[model samples]
Target: MTNAEQPETPLDAVRALRAEFGIDAGRVDQIGRLLTGGDFRTVEEVVSLTGTSRRTVEAVFRALEPDLESSGDGRRVQEGRAAEYRCLFGAREPFGVRDPWTDDARRDPAAVAAMAGLIGAAPPPVQALDHVPATAETVVKRARFMLDGFDLTGAHVLFVGDHDLTSLGLFVAGGAPGLRASVVDVDERLLEFVGAEAARRGWDVRCHFADLRLGLPAALRESCELVFTDPPYTPEGVQLFVARGLQGLRDHRNGRVLLAYGFGERQPALGLAVQKALNPLHLAYEAMLPGFNRYAGAQAVGGAAALYVLRPTRRTAGAARAAADDTRTAMYTHGAQSVEASGGLDAQAAARVLELGADAGEKTLLVGDGWPADAPGRRIALPAFLGAPLPRNLQDHGTALVNLYPGFGASAVRALLAANAHRVGLVCRNDLPLLKDAEGQREFAGLVAPKFRIVRRLRDTPGPGQALVLAERAEPEGDAERVLGYMYARAHGKLGNAWREGLIAARKAAGTTLTKSEGRRAIEASASRPDLLERSLMELPLYLFAVLEGDVRRSVDALPG
Candidate 1:
């Protein structure tokens, strides 16, 4: 057909309306070209094109009225009916859409086993998170399906949240070569676990610590082709995480976001509310596979949730810009238990705080509980509980201690170590002065007796809780301290199981007759407090003496008998 014969199109109509409304000709031209190309022009796009604020974009849409319908709660206003619209860039169904997991992907026994192991190694789920991680089989299926459906071979994938270990499953499945996977999470334990496992497997994976509510890391913004997230099962949580994932898309034109969200049948309204929340983000809903994710223990949703494949439109970009400053910290199912919750101490936790804070003398005590009365030096409350971001003051403190209490474990330990405290201690409840059982002794040895000395062990004659002190051993002196600092810094301040292997390697290289078990014991003894600074002060000296003492035999001789 000749240009003259061409019918007045949506773009032509937009142009006519633009002239009638006296909108900027250049802005109208930009909008016409984009919409004619079958794209959604969001408030963000119009603002960027015309150099205006969101209010102006809203005014333009309102002026257009029925001619251009606003989608995603008005963030994305399009020329056609909402049902006919796909994405801001163009309309395209998700390529290679398939049932959850292909048979071939699920048949690999080794991959399945590896998935199980990874899931087992993940940090224990926080009940407050409503975290019932999917079964290993479910996780393997989800990974396989996502990789295949998304064609993620050799792609740089970003995981906004990874409690399910889907990213690890992708690495283990092994079909996607040269895959560069990265994770950003508030949980330090998850970051540590993923980092160690990735290093062990030699996969190109990097772990970062971030709180989504605070915005994404600047380095990761617009840096990935795909983003996968299984956000908290709340409308606010879903929108925040999904929006963050969308922001991480390197190229919004072709980038995709895979979202896992589910609501109970009885709570259809809740599910609808969640779906509606996506309107502001302006993601093109490509396809949704209901009950695609199967959890092992989430009875609230009948152990399953749907998977959503979303492609970003220009509207998505605009929504992200507008919502960036509007997002809040409490976007979880349990507001009080959310990672943003300020950890305040109860009476028992407070009592232990007094004991831990009693000898702070000229040192900062970053306690989970606020300022203990008569506490020495300065006392500050830190959000050191499960899922909370590590306090910024951790690096400033000389000594850090967490009074062992219910609902606190390795996660707390990880936070203390990450703080870079020079000395770290774990105050316990058991009577350390009279403990004798081998099993009991082993647990205490893991914390105090060996690497840490009993600075104070007291029970005020049937007091409410036992008070036992385990301070960091004095820093190494001379060459030993220098070498120790170098090695610990190289290890990044956390002594995980990998450090044990490294210690064993150092021992063998020194020609030491140290058994692997002995080397393991030494590493464990050095890690009693598990704080990098604490471990360096105590064990790195011995490690350096074994590895760097000039002559191999001399190095072996140098290790304490």
Candidate 2:
């Protein structure tokens, strides 16, 4: 008899499911046994029996739901305390809740609900963007699992990218008292949201803006004990994110990196490619928990990814300094497609201008990240406008085409000024919201009012490109302290006079010739000051030079001159 014309039975149904839906033989057998037996089963039971992921089990049960419902004999039946799935021919009631930890303490519904609401309120994922948040449920479970490993009570945890809102979940979970969690991301909206949430909860969470494609912010490097990141699915993307995260580790030897990546069963090659990317970083593959992460919309990997725990090898510790610069730009989903190029210029064309402009001795510098690395011009590489002094030549009257992007504000302005780029041209996307707001324009004016003249403010939305040239004045009142503050504060956090004193003492104790990094560590270990955060030690000198006007500035001035 033909398969379709054969008499229907439990085994026949299993065969038909395999033929039609591609359900595996094991699952088919389990389902067939459940159909034949007069046993009621829960979703958790089926999941346990088949040794499949919860989501996979759910999908299977969902696919079979219509058929079971049509049977009229299958129904949800309450067995004891909870509802179970029962089908015809002794089928149990349909499975209900999937919570298997019955004995575990119940979660605070209000806290959980708050997180869910916040995640729901976030803007929709951008097309071709690398960021995609896991489901709220998945985030909660992930937080719980992550927290179980270590007591975050006195820990400083760093999240390389928090599109998943794992930081938020950890904050709300609340067991760690002296926990300091910080996040660095390219998205300003996410940063603002996270900052607001931290303020609301009175948590010690800090946010910094940066594009990992350039590098991890100097302020964040070597600042935390633990690191977490959910990077793009691309192999290069994973490597870059992991490398950047490894940079944040306080002690590379003991630091752990938790990474999330997934690939479809049919995409073994893709998974292998991702695995290969890890080798160069010299990470010891500690553990890879299968199906540890779940996504709401990513159905390709069955809406899940695995969590990989990697411990840095000695090689990783030794090569930490070179990790950030090793990443390539085409790490996102769309490669060059997501890049925003304007002014009658495709991405490649703009790259050409950037490359050739420098070669032609036009003093051209690309003021952004994600540009084709193969492009000719050198990147400014200053993710933020920090106090790193510019080369004296660029500090003269040069032309700078600033890429209008995330870190394009006070820092960009400072970078241009310090570089002494006479004509500052802003190259932005057509719809960029730079000069639209009155307040923003006023803020921009306040930053450039004294030193530079705004030659023209061009509005070019829905057009080809917009350009604004800020020309340097003949007799510019270069606010030395303000400029120094911008430079120092951008690179370091808040630094005050006392902090500087402590740092100096620390340096002297370590034999005055200690390197900048060594001096900072010495201060961190020996200083007794409660006035500065551990992360703020590096900023003290900047604070002394910038904020403390007379005595400290005189002291700073007297030392060198």
Candidate 3:
């Protein structure tokens, strides 16, 4: 009888089918027994035996369906039978098996609405191909965290891989100010697509063709402050991709390498590996971008990625080690609080040397060159002869000479040390460049070696100059007593002018009714007394300096030179 017309028992039918399809004897007998017991009848019944859910069974059967009809008739099936509910394992197979993840046919409106109820929105069909767009909110949140954390203002950045959607989101979120972004990729098609989209959004996108398998392009050498990469995680390409990525960081100095590998439990190992690879370069690893898995699709391996911020490792040599040691001691002992509590002893030591003039008490020569008119009595203006020999006058004054200068230079530094080899107090700036050099060794040797007391003003507020107070030791020495008297006279003349100018301007600015002549007289009198000069200088800024100086004399009256 014809196969279609024949009627057969379940066991006989299953047995015959096994023989025709070359089924294994054991499986054939099992199938026969299942059908004989009424456990299976159609393809659906056979698929149910596999223990898969009904939907999966239906999808599998649908995938096995024929794509074309028999022959002369250009139709899949003749009209009437097409709608008939045929048995599974019948002549016709089911449909849509090729892509079970998505439906190929036009979605039924009712079905679409029903699915929407569950997911909040009908998902875009799988066939509706395009770049997966990340949510604007997600982009903004991630971008803000990156920008704020990395201080990305005015930084150059490179974006690698296909994160066009995320990149667009960053643009919308108003990424770092003055950031220049360059996008690199191997796929020209994707590049064109993203470039067009970026253009539409008014982004100044620079596209570069990069084949990472061959290592990073030469163009990437020390060019970027931040290199952002989002790489795929499949085993096929992951290893090679990561290797190249690590190589890309060689060009970075203080550059940060942001690698976005998807999230998962074992992700820490991957992060650790990346950290180890970059550790030699002194780069640090952190999770800069979180929550990356929401849109990467189910096939993506990891759920989140990490970013590495790198900085050049500082090298320590013998000199640096010594300097570091000294600074450590300074930090622990002579720091801000320590200096404040001690009332600036180191400064005081320097100041004492400047107060005692080079000569004992002979002709005291007072020098004031650009010494801020507002300095205190103990202050002096020494020349910028840091490397030069001490002046003859200074050598003659010796311990009694107080070299007062608003600031010190190389020439002044040398002269101070040589001229007053024993007793000169050198009053100089706290900002002397040599102070910051090699842990202030040059400055320390220059000012501290001569047994001269260095004194400096408390740098609590901004001002034009630094103040120092130096005192010469009262002792019997060769020509020392005479030099001490002369030093006091010089200090009187120089400090008198500084104290006068500072007090006058201060009082005038404070709206004090004191006339210029009156202010000058007051400054002159204050200079005669060091204690009064200090008080007046301090009071000037608070009550003077800010108010309008009305009816003030521009030039001081000629004093006996």
Candidate 4:
């Protein structure tokens, strides 16, 4: 049939389709334009032009089929390249329209009666003062998942922040049977809103108004097991919130603090600063909630937000004592040597001994009278004879015992070995009584027995003017030239001519033949190569010796062998 001769489609049918499907006004105009152009003669054409799936097009047509009239043969046919299903007459009457939110529309008696008939009377109030009502079902679902991991029964949970849309919604979604959930906010308006909502739902909720910046209320001290805090969006606000939140938990026995904050590339420095502040406090971050801004809205500004779970510091008095004891045990079992005052084995002497050990594939210990505050090695501090037990965390790292002494005792030596008995190469020299006593000897033997193969020697007296000793428990695997190159780089200018001379004397006494110039060249070459210096120092042999001798200071001075 000709286009003008075809039956007119009523406007009513089109309007009904638009209202029922919630199609945008602009999309409806586009459909009208297509119809005027005679482009929507078939269902397939409508689907193709609308960019909607076939099933959706069919559904739309089905909804409007009753309002449409058929014309021509009223047959479904296949065109040359396109498929067609015909809807004959156009729309006629327009559909009714009303505002979605007007009180009349929302509370219309007829509408309320119909709804009541369908679902029965409104759901019972779960609580007394429900402030915020929840709408987004997905949010509730995700929150339920987070709560699954926690045991909230009988727990005092505090939500701190402004009671906005999200807070209110969360209150409703998370309010469980027998769970006490309270909201704390500085703004009274938000609290009132929450209180009203709770009252509507018959929910029993407590509202507290306080300036979080000033610190938590004294009443909450040690009472909260979980504090959920979403701070203001600003960095300053975040910092203040974290500080105050942490302080609030000082008296908590097993309390946890949850913080929510926004972060972004533009303010990476702020995030790093927060991390620095939290690290010393030993707080660990558990999980992050991204895209929280949808609910936080403008409060979240533009960046992403994350949730951090923090707990109190984990370090204990016993751990500190154990660490100290370990240092002493390491020193005695490794046989740290004391540099004789007349030997002139200063820092330069210690550095050279480290180099010689590196070159000879042996480990050496240079026990000084005082700690090298900037020394590059493991540091062990020994205080009093048997101060607190050594820290519990100290572990044997194959070689090295850099002992620092405030004052020493036989217990220091025992603690050092007890902590690092597995390490190889024992270089111990102390003014304290040697492990000459039977009990001391047995303890030393027990520590060294399993790892004695790495120990180069038992005890060797140094020659006059010789401030250090190069003990070879095991020969390193490599060309002497390369080994010397590594040591030279590590020692840098720290190894002076005097130290090299002492090394030559020590090696000569050990029955190794080498010229003074060769020894000097080897030391100089190693010191010059930066790459070899660090690597050589870390090797099994050099690492053990350097760590032990370089770190020994006055801490072990009073320690009994």
Find the candidate with the highest TM-score and give its number.
2
Candidate RMSDs in Å, in order, are 16.7, 9.4, 28.5, 28.6
Assess each prediction's global lDDT (C-alpha) against the native. Answer: 0.57, 0.56, 0.36, 0.38
lDDT of 1 by residue, 289-348 (tens): 876777765555656678899989878887976666454545665534364564434555
TM-score of each: 0.50, 0.64, 0.30, 0.31
Q: Which candidate should be chosen as best, given lDDT against the real structure?
A: 1
Lowest lDDT 10-residue stretch of candidate 1: 536-545
lDDT of 3: 0.36
Model 2: residues >4 Å from true position, as ranges?
Answer: 1-110, 121-124, 318-323, 334-388, 392-394, 403-419, 435-454, 457-561
Which tens-of-lDDT digit does each residue in 201-308 have in candidate 3? 666554544434323443443456666655543332333333334344444445555555433332356445544433433334433433332332322222123333
* lDDT per residue (tens digit) for residues 1-561 in model 4: 376643354344455555655634333433343344433345545433443334444544553454433345231222321111123223432211222222332333443333233222223221111112221332333234335546766666666653332333434445455565566654444555555565566655555544442234434434555666656444444444555455444334466677755444234676776566445445556554443322312221232244566665564222322322222112110122121112223455345444433333323222324424444444443332112223444332334433222122222222333233233222334333333355655444433222232233233222222322122122223233223322322321232343345345445555665566665554554442221222211111211233322222111121122
Is 3 or 4 the stronger prediction by lDDT? 4
Candidate 3 ranges with C-alpha deviation above 4 Å: 1-136, 234-251, 266-282, 286-293, 299-561
Q: How well does candidate 3 score on lDDT at residue 519?
A: 48
Quote the lDDT for 336 in model 1.
Answer: 46
What TM-score quantifies how close candidate 3 is to the native fold? 0.30
What lDDT does candidate 2 reach at residue 385? Answer: 26
Clashes of each: 2, 22, 66, 64
* Regions more than 4 Å wrong, model 4: 1-142, 165-171, 247-254, 299-303, 314-561
**In candidate 1, how many clashes are counted?**
2
